[model samples]
Every structure is written in structure tokens, then in C-alpha cells.
Target: VIGVKRRVHGGLRFTIPVSPFDRIRALKQECDRLVAQAPPDLPVLFEQVLRFERMIAASGVDSVPSHADGLASNILIGPDGRIELVDFDGAGNVDPYYEIGILINEVFEDEKDFLPALEMFEGTPRPASLRRARLYAIADDLAWGLWGLVMDATSQRKDVEFYRYGFWRFIRCRAALERVDFGSYARML
Candidate 1:
């Protein structure tokens, strides 16, 4: 057999220099734009947004360097089983729980897996953090659902099912919010 050599590429830095406050403001603006463009009948979306805003305002957790967007499409797994992340345009110092929340929301479909997934991330899961992550997931879904709506209206690419994507996100968000545990999450915070 001929000798073969393999090389693994080093992990790519998925961050660009950005001020945390500036990034926060930009995120808010983007969310606002999406909300404005979205149809107005979404009470659940509005409630989630308000709670999220309050949560951010009152959060005791310090911001840390992390990926601001956790869409699975931004992550890549190499044939060699190496993982890399892309899309640093939104990278900045943000609440680490928010980062983990986005990742957990994207990675897990069953709500039952949320606490266990948190354990995977934190080594030992903390209930408060789990609650925070859940809240963030709700907000993330709402924001992305609105984004889908806005994109459907503005995007010239009619081939893409933007409305369907948004509707699904909204359904997920609303379902999560309407669950019995949702209030428990809010009260725990």
C-alpha cells in the first residue's frame, strides 16, 4: 500500500472586531425592521419581544466574545470530521447564554433534550441558564420568523419559500410560548 499523508486545517476564527453595544443596537434595529414589515396580528411575537428586551436590560450575565448568529448553515463539518464556523459579520461580545440558546435551538428538535443539551455545553447544567436559553430560543424564533416574512415580501427570489419558513418559525415560537412551562421560565427569571 502506498503511504498517504493527511493534513487538518486549523480552526478558523469566526469573529471580526465589533463593539458590543454597537452590535446590540444593530441587532435591535434589524429586529425592529423585521417586526415593522411583519403582519401585525402576532400578539405572541410582540409579547416575546417585550420579554426578551426586558431580559436583556436586566440580565446580570456579562457579555463575552461569541458568534451572534447561530444558524446551522453557518456551521460546516469537514469530511475529516472537523468542524468550522463561518459568518462573523454579526460576531461580538454578547451574552454567552444567548449564543448557547441559539445553538441549542438550532441543534435540538425535542424540548425534552434542552436541559441535557445545556449540560453538554456547561458540563453541569444550571436551571437559571436553562431558563435563559429557553427564553432566548423563543425570541430567536420570533425574530427569524419575522425575518422570513420580510424576506418573502422584499426578496426578488420567488423560488425560495420565505413565507413558509417564517410561518414555521412563528408556529414553533408560538407553541413554545403557549406551553405551561413558558410562564415558569419567565417567573424564574
Candidate 2:
């Protein structure tokens, strides 16, 4: 078949649909932004983002409808355990692992919990997918970190510490990027 389409839930809002390439390009643009307190390894981080973009292009994975910003703040769990999703501003079709990666990164603070949680999501753990998820998480951090910096620089709101939040994300991204197995993960992809 030349193409395939899957019907998504009616409630899902993909009004701002975007391709993974769009996301990558946006990240690249964000990297060009000047931040006085930017991470010391900004150059390396930029390089990694480009490398992952290439890997993703070569993967030939089909994009699926996803609430691209699957951060914890957008999720709500009722007392009966019914899960509800909100904030579709960034909803779009993206690599399935991007969605999974966001969830794994947000829900599991400890790296040790990532694999088991991934297993629960996939019904069986696939190391390669995990690597992809981890890489996606790093990309997420860089994207949001840059976003925070922009917001901090421009927003008049004093209620939020946008700069601090952005720097924190940069720190997280740096840590994950520096992991000893990070190279192996990239190679596996």
C-alpha cells in the first residue's frame, strides 16, 4: 500500500498538525536563539539534535496522531482511574515513540523505571525503541528549554520563573546526552 490512514477519536484536536520534520526544524531555529545562561554544551546539544533528526528521517517510521505535548500538566486522572487529556495546542501527527518518549520522561523521574514502564507500554520491551524514546526525551528537553528561555525573555509575567525552568530542562538534557550509553543508543538507532 502506498499510504494508510487511521481514524482517531473525535475529541482529539489536531488543528495544528505538524510533521516530525517541522518539529526538528523548529528545534534548530530555537538553538540559534541567544541565551546568556545557556548550557555550556550548547554546541554539542545542537549537533545531537541534528543527528537525531537524521536518524528519524532514516527510520521510515509512520507518524501517528499524537498529543505532542503529553506533559504531566496536561493529564488528569480521576479517582476511578479514568484518564483525561487536555491542552491540544501542540497536537499533531508524529512518530509514535515521540508520544511514548514524552510520557516515559515525565512519568518516570528515575532512569531505572524507564525500561519497565516502556515494557508496560509495548507489552514487551524493545531496546531499540527505548533508545529512541530516550533520544526523544532529550530532544523534548532541548525544545522546552529553549521555549522557556524565549518566554522568559519576552513574557511580562513575573509569576513564573521561566528562565530557571528553561535552564533546568537544559541541565536535564545535558545529563542524558552525556550518559555513557548515549552513543550506544544513537548507534542502535
Candidate 3:
């Protein structure tokens, strides 16, 4: 048997007052802004995003799936900047790309810089990392979307705009998921 003790008092936590739902709402709004700004006939970009999502889902091998709760907030960074993961509450049965995608989303909000982070995370040009990151990013969107819904259900309608944002995120996530390359990722699972 193994036992782990809490290292720092209270451990790592964000100072941001926004709940997970608020963050998701913000992300959805940002996605909408980006999509609205895209060229009217940007099918190529959309196709590329789909291909990337497919690749990300396919990155992991069977038997050693990735951690499900790979969010940056769950990671504890020491004074020396080394990372220690906390709260494996959602652990197990995930693709390896899950962590990679989460990390990419946290550090690089800009789509342009996302590729570089993707390259570093995958450690190889598998092309699947792109798809995985996209999927993970969409997952982030979904997470926030649900968060907003939960807040609304709990009667926190003070932030109605957040719920609207969540709806937008859900729509965007669905759009992206529909184009994902499920075959590649499913084969590994």
C-alpha cells in the first residue's frame, strides 16, 4: 500500500473568483469572437481543425490511458517550478492526449501558438496531436458550458450572459466534434 501526505498548506488553487462555469462562458464567448472573425470561406481551416482533433484522440496506446482531469488548475507547481498533480478524482480511462491537450490550452490561448505547444507535448509529428488538442479544447468548452448550466440550475441567474455563452460553447463543441477523426483514436482504445 502507498500513502501520500498533503505537502503545502491548502495546496494549489487559483485566486480567480470566476467559477468553472464563468470560465467556460468566457471561453465560449472567445470562440464565438474568433469564429465570427474567420474568413467567410475558411473551410480549409475547419478541415485542418478536424484532422488535428482526430490525431489527438489517437495518440494514446491501450492499457495506459491518460488522466481525465488534466486541467492546469489540478497541477501543483512547486517553488522550483516542478509540477505535482493533485486530485485524481476523475482519473482513469482517458486518452494520453488528454493531458497534452489540457496543457496546450492553458499556456497558449492563441491558436497560432497552439501548434508549437502541441509539438512539444506530443514529442513527435504524429499529426494526431492536433486533433487531440482540438478535442481537448472542445472538452474545455463543454466543461464550462455545463458549469454555466449548473450555476443557472442552482439559481445563480445573476449571470444570465454566462449561460448564453455556455450555449454558444456547446454549439461550437458539437460542430468541432462532428468533424473529428474518430477512427484513429477509437483504434487505440
Candidate 4:
């Protein structure tokens, strides 16, 4: 990757796009939709949520370092569906859970199925397979929750609804944590 700096009247210049921010907002909407349709089996859901929370908490605490952004747009595909990650701006000192959360949200948004992705990551190491993805969902929710709050506080009234939606996600994540089988994820912590 290349980093560039521009001269601005004898000063340095830096520029950032608004797309990442927009992508973050879009991902949150997708996550909310999936969470609303999450299966009623509280035990399974709790286990998933608990696993995700542990991953997010650990990522935030710097236990592991992996690309924190795992969305369809960030994925570059080759023939036969081979793929590679294209963006790493949000990739520092982050939890695998946040990436999982984004993946879950995207899969659900596209296929309306969370089980397949969930199964894909099952039995994997903490922040390595499904556990990491699951954690991303929680971390993304938390991160977006803060983002939403910031938008609201800044008088971005159009984003208020999104912020509230994120708040609900945070609440659901907490509920999931409460219902999680701690034994499953405690080792990672």
C-alpha cells in the first residue's frame, strides 16, 4: 500500500474518503436486520453472542492483531471465487470479532442465513475462524454504537435513527453476553 502527502501552501495535506464511514453505516443496517431475525433458540444465539463479545473485547484489548474490516467490498475476488482483502485502514490492533460481525451482517444481508457462516467458523481457534467473525459482529456493534452517538452529538439528525439502532444492537449484544455459555469462550479471555 502507498501513503501520500500533499503540499498545501507550504504545509502538509492529508485526505480521507467518506466511503469507509458510509460503508460502516451500511454494515450496521445490515447487522440490525439480521439480528432482528436471529433464531429463537436463545442458547445457540447466546453462545454465538458470547463468543463474539469475547473476541471483540480481546481485540480492543490488543490480544490479537488482524484485519478488522471484512466486508464484501473489501474483498477482491479472482477466478473460481478466490478472494483477497483489499483494505486495511481499519485493521490495526483490532479483534477478530469485529470482522466476524461484519461478515455475519453481510452474509445475512445477502443470503438471509447466518448458520452457514457460523458453521464455517466453528471449532476454530479464538479470533481465527468463526469465533473471530462472531466477535467482529459485537465489536462492530460497539464501534458503530459510538459512531452513532458521535453523529447524534454533532447534530447529524439524519443519523440519529441509525445511532438508536446501534444502541439497540449494543443492548442485544449485552443480552447475548448474559445468555452465553461462558465455558466456551472463557479460555480465550
Candidate 5:
């Protein structure tokens, strides 16, 4: 299958979404903002996952350039059924399997529910990649959780809805954290 990789000839005028590791502090600030706005009874699970992600960041990985923003909104389908990827704003050096986790978590309700996304990429995903995807999926949860908070903080038009969305994302992130087999994945490394 053929793929298109766009090349930029000069310095970009617009901002790009930095890779997750680089954006950790900003993301955490957003997470903190969300927590501050939330009630006292909010679950600690989101915090737990965020802390774990911080640990992962310090340990580090060899950055392989790939799309950091893989939300369903960025993908475009042609009339002839061909696929076109639109957003490169968040494309940069990061984990190779990064998008899989984002794609799986964003597009599916269950970890076991893998289909069109699983089929979208070439070859059956390996155990290592799947495991990494699971781990990264947890991270994606935190990212989206923070995103909701930003929306909640910024949007006047969707104030109530954004608050609900922010809290919901936190809850969702916590659930994904609970589902991760930390012990099993740790052993894999």
C-alpha cells in the first residue's frame, strides 16, 4: 500500500502539538485545573495514572516520529473509499505504537472490542505492540481528560456540557487505568 508523507520546506508559522512527553507539564497543569474545579469526592484514579505517566516520561524511549493526534476527527474517507489523513499539526517524534492506543481508546468502548481500527493498520499487532498500546491507551485517557478540562475552562457556549465532558473523561481515564495489567506489562520490559 502507498502512503503520503508531506514535507515542509521552511519554518512553520503555526504551532504544532508537541509530543506527549514534552507536553506532560502543560497536560498535568490542565489535569490539576480540572481537579480543582471538580468536587472533593472525585476519584484519585486519574491522579494515579498521571503520576505513573510521569514516571514513564523520566525513564524515556527512543522517539520514532509519528502522528501524536490520532483522534477520529482527524481522519478523512474519500468517496472512492480511499483513506486520507488530514492533520499533521500533532505529528512528530514519539512512540511508534502511540496512535494505536489513542485510536483504540477513542474509537472503541471496550479493550477487547478491536475491529476496523485493528484492521486499519497493516499486519496483526504483536504481543509487545498490543501491550504497549494498552499502556499508551492509559496515557491517552489522561490526555483526553485534560483536553476536556481545557474545553471546560474555555468554552462559554458549552459550559455545562464541557464540565460534564471533563468529569466524564476523568472517570473514563480512571477506568482505563484500572483495567491495565501493570504487573504483566512491567514484566515484558
Candidate 6:
């Protein structure tokens, strides 16, 4: 990663080419029933996330540290045009790649959109980080999928979209799991 000198014109990173069809505009559900019925794959994804984090820490990149939640709304562009990352509510010392992973997955949402954005941002893309991002993205999908089901079951918000959303997330998670050779990526741990 080239050392970036923060200049003014504070930019809030914006993703391009996101189709309206895939957007999850609100997170904004059921709690108990969904938890009880959550899929087994979610737990597997969590275990993988732990292994990925461990491997990333040992990869030896000078980490800027990880902010597990890199949601777009959490970032800001200062009035003076400087990039600002706020909301350190649960920030932690973690593999730097984890933060990028969160941001990339959040911005790209669909797998189809990831490569182009990655290539543009990274210039030529680094295998280690790109692979790591894959791990994180997979983990995120599983996590959100479970959360959606839980919220759908527990929340009073009677939107059937919650159920559909959970189903969609799980579908993506399964597809991603099939897509990546995580066993190879695990060796980095």
C-alpha cells in the first residue's frame, strides 16, 4: 500500500455502478425464532473469520489496524475536504486487511461489482489482500444472513422483505463459499 498523504478536498468514498435492485437500504425484524433456526453455515463462517484474522495479523503488513465495522455512513468528508473516519465504538487492533475487506464488501455488495472496484482502487490488486477480502466478505455475508433471519423473526416490523433479505444473503454466502478456495487462503494463517 502506498503511503497516502492526506490532502484536503475531504472525500467520502462513494461506490460507483451499484444497481438499485440489490441495495439493502435499511437494516432497519425477529430475534429469538431466527436465532434458534439460524443455519449451521453461519457458525462455520465465524470460525473461518477467526482463522482469517489470525493469518492476516501474521502476514506482516504494517497495519493501520482494523475497524471491524467500516460502514459507509461511519466515514465522512470534513468541511476542509479531508477524509475522516469516525465512530470508533468497537474498533480493535486487527489485521489491516479486515477493514478494507469490510469496506470493499459493503461498497460492492454484489460479487459482480467487486473486481472492477478492487482493480481500480488497488491499481493492480495484491493477491494476499484480495484473497483476504474474499474471506471477510464471505464471513460478512453469513453473518448478515443470520442476523436478518433473527431480526425477521424477532422484530415487530412486519415487512416480508426481512425474510427475503435473509434468504438472499444466505444464497450469496453459499455461492461465495463455493467460489473461493478457502483452504488455500487458510495456509496464510
Measured against the true structure, the TM-scores of the candidates, in listed sequence, are: 0.76, 0.83, 0.50, 0.44, 0.73, 0.59
In order, candidate lDDTs are: 0.66, 0.71, 0.50, 0.46, 0.59, 0.55
Candidate with best lDDT:
2
Residue pairs clashing in model 1 are none
What ordering of candidates by TM-score runs from best to worst? 2, 1, 5, 6, 3, 4
Please identify which of the two predictions, 2 or 3, would achieve the higher lDDT against the true structure. 2
Question: Candidate 2: what lDDT?
Answer: 0.71
Among these predictions, the greatest TM-score belongs to 2
RMSD of each: 6.9, 5.0, 10.8, 11.5, 4.8, 8.9
Clashing pairs in 5: none
What is candidate 3's local distance difference test score? Answer: 0.50
**Which residue runs of candidate 6 sit more than 4 Å off their true CA positions?**
1-65, 76-87, 109-124
By descending lDDT, how would the candidates be arranged? 2, 1, 5, 6, 3, 4
Name model 4 segments beyond 4 Å from true.
1-67, 70-88, 93-98, 109-115, 118-132, 155-160
Q: For model 2, how does the per-residue alpha-carbon lDDT over 1-189 read when each residue is reduced to its tens digit? A: 001112332235455555544565575566456455666776777777667777766766766677666578887778997666778777776776777777778788888898887776667978788888887888888777877877776779979999888889888888888773646655776
**Predicted structure 6: clash tally:** 12
Residues 107-189, candidate 3: write the lDDT tens digits.
56555676776565545635555655566676665765555545544444684765576566566656656665567654533
lDDT of 2 at 175: 86
The candidate, 4 or 6, that scores higher on TM-score is: 6
lDDT of 6 by residue, 9-125 (tens): 122322232211122212212333235665666556545545555665566544333334656787777788666666755354444455556667777767666666556545676
- Report the lDDT tens digits of candidate 4 across residue range 40-114: 443343345444444445544432344445556876668976656667676443333344456676546532254
Question: Could you tell which candidate, 5 or 6, scores higher by lDDT?
Answer: 5
